[model samples]
Target chain A: MSCVTPSWSVAMKKNQLRVNEFGLIERFFRPLAVNNPGSASLQDDCATLSVKKGYQAIYSMDTMVEGIHFFKDDPADLIAKKLLRVNLSDLAASGGHPRGYLLALCLPHGFPLKWLENFSAGLQDDQTKFNVSLVGGDTTSSNGPITLSITAIGEIPKGRVIRRAGAMVGDDIFVSGCIGDAAIALKLFEEIGRAKTLKHYPSLYNRYILPEPRIGLGKLLAGTATACIDISDGLYADLNHICLASKVGAKIEMGAIPLSICATNIIEKNKDYWESVYGGGDDYELLFTANKDQRNVIENFASILNISISKVGCIQSGKGISILDQFGHVVPVRSFGWQHF
Target chain B: MSCVTPSWSVAMKKNQLRVNEFGLIERFFRPLAVNNPGSASLQDDCATLSVKKGYQAIYSMDTMVEGIHFFKDDPADLIAKKLLRVNLSDLAASGGHPRGYLLALCLPHGFPLKWLENFSAGLQDDQTKFNVSLVGGDTTSSNGPITLSITAIGEIPKGRVIRRAGAMVGDDIFVSGCIGDAAIALKLFEEIGRAKTLKHYPSLYNRYILPEPRIGLGKLLAGTATACIDISDGLYADLNHICLASKVGAKIEMGAIPLSICATNIIEKNKDYWESVYGGGDDYELLFTANKDQRNVIENFASILNISISKVGCIQSGKGISILDQFGHVVPVRSFGWQHF
Candidate 1:
């Protein structure tokens, strides 16, 4: 972990201290640990985590590197939040509530100091919203691209985690929130350029830059969802995940897929945009299967949570994910890119 | 972490598949998760960690960047092992036994696939030795140095963790194994150059390459030691951590500090090397403090565990670590570099 104890003591002097590695911790990292009692103010070697009795501690990690996962000039705060939310989404899909997280940051040489201030500010905002504390982390400077990894820790009651393996034949498939906004946003940025895309379609751009992790809804789906996953690799791609794990196939009606007004408008004008609506990724929305009889219970959940839920498909007794037309014609989309005619 | 579900299914055909992200996981990573039942063969969203009913889950994380933490040409196996051991040492120092770990790897473009085979081989060797499993991790290609981070999870009995804050005045300070081998090996590499140094002192070279985390001895010292820390930063620097955290100072008898035969010979020829003996780092040995009355019991532990135990100092009621001369004269080393000369 970088160097924990200094060569000789570099006493922290608030605000005026030089921005060395130690100063970064005192100014930007230490305050994040206040919510986690086991963090020991990021002083000791390891953090002590007390997992509640009968609950299993759970965690998922994701790493983001500048120029790869995100643009170098993207707002540092949004980048930080997206890194956190994406990992939180993994735990959320497993029906867990986050407790704390550990961060490992490799800062490239000559990176702007103001970016870090904004980055930590973003972590502060999300920690409050997600009810998580910064436990401990390692920070070091590198001569390469800026890299960040966060391991988000949470807990779920034993045996209650909604997994990707429990979907059964005839189970109704559902998705949370609007899908394809992020992937479409990225497509627009690629086609029309980022500046124009952001100016004309800011909502889609915002969806790409910031994803909302559905933790509350995921926890609510614990016993209800026969199988669950977060839609990170597009609807059809993630649907295949459930199909493969459960040894079942999925038939999704292309007409029933939900989309944001922005995505719907764009797709209507350019039929090619419909490709992104089905096959584009980075949707941090929950996708799951439940017994067909649970429709009323699931609908009530959508109304109560005030997020749209759409029944777009059903599990079938076979192998791959099929994108179906309104007339029940199946379009093969597995083992290859979408085989749409 | 990594985009787990593939875009389109690329069914694996043994060694013939292209080395894409999914192929890498199927070939190198899936086996690592077999021991952890909750890992679900590394196919699920998050790993479920079961903390023993009466124990608290503990974890520590470390990130090592190529060219910073290790030589670019260092064996891939040793680099992977060092990364895991350094993190395990933290949990070891806290009176815990590791259960599993999560790894995040950022591989530079063109990094050889062969290196990963050796790296995972190293992890397999250590996991067998330490009884830990790989829970989950993320791997991605990066334009930067290969940055690796491991978050090790373990458990310690409730209310029994030996924290750095528990050291008290009059406690006998103890250290495990030899102290300066790593720093001196690094110094030798810098002075005599790597080839000649490796030819001459392979023991010291190996010592620098692979640190033996004191997991067995650390677990043995659990209730016996009042406070503890693993020496990653040099002896004096790490000692200062206990002093700062416990609000106590230390008086170290230099004559009592243990040294290896290799270090002793080096110090005899060049007294300048003595600086690193006290001020150098990467000694993953446990440095601890126990009540003075427990001297006999501690001695018995050394004999039982078959590792040398040196009582080099005592906790004192003030602040800072004083390195004492043969005649018990204190040398000032508080606010600056060693004033020992």
Candidate 2:
């Protein structure tokens, strides 16, 4: 049977042209006000926020558009939840505690109220879970697809924030959680329709739809990790980031990669499994490198935190990233990574 | 002559898929290696920033998309500059000084490299002018209109950040600069063939393309203005935000509104003048309210700053907004303001 496609065009057919953005702001956005102690309210010229007395703030923004990032028929709540989470993932990678976020939403005309309600509910859930507040946002209507932009702010102890350029030549690289599950999940969802079988295993599909940002691990690794990044693109591509930023290189053992059982199963069932593992996107894992001696400590910390930590590679004194096969020979690998532009 | 209208469908082509946002971290977004004492290199997991050691950070985000917020033919440099300035306007409205920002760009495949070079140049200009450094960003290709999301981080002295809820019952409301130029400029551009007269006034057209964010005024009014907001939507709707947030109403003498010479000229020549002044959007002026005692100081400051300041109205005890006609009577308005949805 042909899979049912979501009709985004139908979902977006409304009299949005007749109404200007300001009117919508007065009607819908104003009523959902939250009193921010740092700033007076969203109605002000700009929000004035008070960060903690001594700590510095970390800020990041991410935007998603319908039919560009995800299917139009994708669940509205999931889309909203992912938008916030992706931004939070940035904060997490920065090793900061989520504090607050600003949202800018441009909705296509004819968006259902149900979608708004679900989206807001998902936002509320994530906000409460991450201990973040919604400070301010702009909601407007458009003649195009629905788009969401979220700017998240977080605070970290003075001098404790980590960055991407600190990797030493001998630092051991590590990634949290099994790799490639999200990409594999997307494949499964696309191939099998509905993802009903994976519903019983929420870990796989949830990772694809709603990633669990590694905020705690990121914070814990702030002063310890030599360099770090969130794995949104595939693992190899993400690690290449550390390599480029630190002016170093990396060598990963293909056999040591931590793959989810479900991911392995799906990959075994499909001939193009490599694509899911190497080129899949939307995995919000943190890939970092630490001093070689800190390996045992990182392992212990991961165990204590009940999160997976895999020793996938090590930093070297060269440029570019390389993956070693089981025979310990340098293998020619395609630059398998996701690109936006 | 017929206007050259780019087909919306052609303008919406997607770029090559990017699967490696992290991979380019080193290649594209590395911090300046020389490191100023203030530079927070991308070394730690997150940026460790010091906001005057004691001040809190203010944050805001804004996103713009092609075919929605801007046209395909819009100059890329102006687009980049406006995106950052708009976010700064938000900070200015809140009484904060810009420190840094994160950017996320989703570009279509056909986006010209020259466009990017010009866009980056514009960003570099603003970064220097505003003392904001680009800390990090994600770039991806999309199968849709180009989208940009900018998240700005700013600092404000503790207890000095202004908000919208502080307006007093009798505070005088003011706006910086004449309004309606941007709206008229857009109209002129849309009807350029028939409105050949507009080509002679490039400054008026520039208003629509490049809006000066009122950061200086925002910071100046931080300690003075009881309530403030950036006029993105229009006079009526944005001010209504201050009224709703401050739990007060306002009565504006329509005659006192500051209209640009260009706007006045266009209004006199056009049939729908009131619509342009009252409903035209994209005017990035600061609309603020202050205690009556501070009026002289504000006027002097405006003079010192070389920006026009107009007192348009006063806060009143009520729940909604009203416009006073020449005879000093409340007249029924057609609509409150523009609505995007």
Candidate 3:
């Protein structure tokens, strides 16, 4: 993967007021807790949460390090939104409803307080958008680049939450939104103004920065989908999780996999880009499987949610993922998906 | 705040085997979930947690960074134990019982898989000791030093949780266990061989590395203590939090503050070290406030728990923490506590 450092010029500000940790929290993060009674206004050592009767809680945590998961120059709000949304995406894959989240921010000493303010504002925006609130967190100084970690909490009915091991043979493989836009957008980041297709479809740039999690679709698929996962490490990599966990195989038709128009144009321009389009990650879309009989109900759900739902493959009584070409033959790929290592 | 980089000579090993991300997780982390049904053997994107009926869940997060939180050459196992125990300490402050936790680990590329093995072993040890399990987390490559973040979840009876804002004016400030051992030990790090006192009190050095969270005492204080907090950011700084939150002040007698024989010996050598002894952090002891009448009950609780309980101060109807000398005059200090900034 190409590593391009974004312009940090805008983030370099002057005359910023120096603030201590407590002051930073009070001025910035406290407002995000306006609606969460359990947060206790960030006063107590721990936040309080009450699970409703007959429901189980879903917990997940992810960390994003500067220059690795995101560029240092990325907008604070977009970064915040991406952090929260990615965790929510995990909850979505689990067929759970978002409730609240905890954040741990490790910043370099002398970090700009304005950046903290913008980051908090970003969280505030998403706290309202996703109906989740900030509950508790720790703020500490790091000797390295900025790192943010979040643990998102959600709720699901007991015995109803979907797992990767639940996929069965003959289940229809489905995806909630277009795949690979984030990866393609990241590729075009190097080409930017020189790419003709990007001139017409500039939204792909924002797609790489901020992913739209399929929360409503996931909730809708709670009863319909047999197995589910979020596409963060590319379709093949994530699908392999379900395959390995369920002890099943899958055959995804390369031509049937949904793609954004911009991704299609880029892939058509160069066959080499197909690898990234198929294997690159960070799509944050739901990849799931359901019984063939539930196709009509899923279609109705997609229609009601006004989102695209594609049937791309089927679960087979085997192991590993196969990409079936347009000629109905399996085509081997160089890599499955993004590997952090 | 002396920044001493410890020797990394022991951490470096030859011909260390390389492992992919998934392989590392499978070999190192999966076993930590041996008894946690909700962990699903670390396969699912989210972990399942069911809160018992009539109970409220408590959530908290804390981060530890190499060089800042711990020396870069520190044993991976000790680092892991400290990370989990710190979060558990917070749960203890809230009068919550340990349940489970999620961890996010960011390590530099080419990090030794052996280090991961030792780190997982450390977590396994604490999971057994604390009865908490690892549910879910994200492991990603970092460009800088190792960073670890954990979000611990705990359970408490409904409406029986403790907070830092419930202390009354006449409440007595009580602290569990000895304090300043960690800070004093940290101060002695540079004088290891030169200081004869450290040779006599080697346990203080171990106390600095490993903190024993007062889980039983905290549970006992749930209904009796008015307000409670864990002493991670020094006693004066944390007590000031309760003062600010509960709109109260405190007058602590310097002579009455609990201290181990080792800490007492170190402080007796130099009166100027009293600031760190009093306001230095990382003790992880429980500093709480309770009605004067509940003193005997607290002593009984401490007796049963086999821990020391000391009443060092009384909450006043004012604003800041006042440290009284042996002669009843206020002693001005250089710093309040450990400040992240």
**What local lDDT score does residue B254 receive in model 3, on the 0 to 100 scale?**
91
Worst 10 contiguous positions by lDDT, candidate 2 chain A: A1-10
Interface RMSD in Å per candidate, to 1 decimal? 6.8, 11.1, 10.1
RMSD of each: 4.4, 6.4, 5.8
Error of 3 at A97 (Å): 0.5
Index of the highest-TM-score prediction: 3
Residue range B226-318, candidate 2, lDDT tens digits: 988887767787788789888999999988989877777778888565665665667889999999999899998899899999999999998
Better of 2 and 3 by TM-score: 3
Top DockQ: which candidate number? 1
Q: What is candidate 2's lDDT per residue for A44-89, written digit by digit as tens?
A: 5455555676677676667776765666776888888888888888
True contacts kept of each: 0.47, 0.46, 0.62
Query: A1-341, model 1: which lDDT tens digit per residue?
Result: 22222312344334332465556787889999986789998878888877677788898988888776788888999999999999999999999989889999887544566888999999999999888889988887676788999998999888888889999999999999888888787778778888998899999978887899999889989999999999876787778878888999988999999988999999989977777767777888999999999999999988888999999989999787778888999765533322100
lDDT of 1 at A240: 80
List the candidate 3 regions with Cα displacement exceeding 4 Å. A1-17, A190-201, B1-17, B190-201
**What DockQ does each candidate score versus the true complex, computed on alpha carbons?**
0.43, 0.34, 0.41
lDDT of each: 0.82, 0.72, 0.83
Ranking by TM-score: 3, 1, 2
Worst 10 residues of 3 chain B by lDDT: B1-10
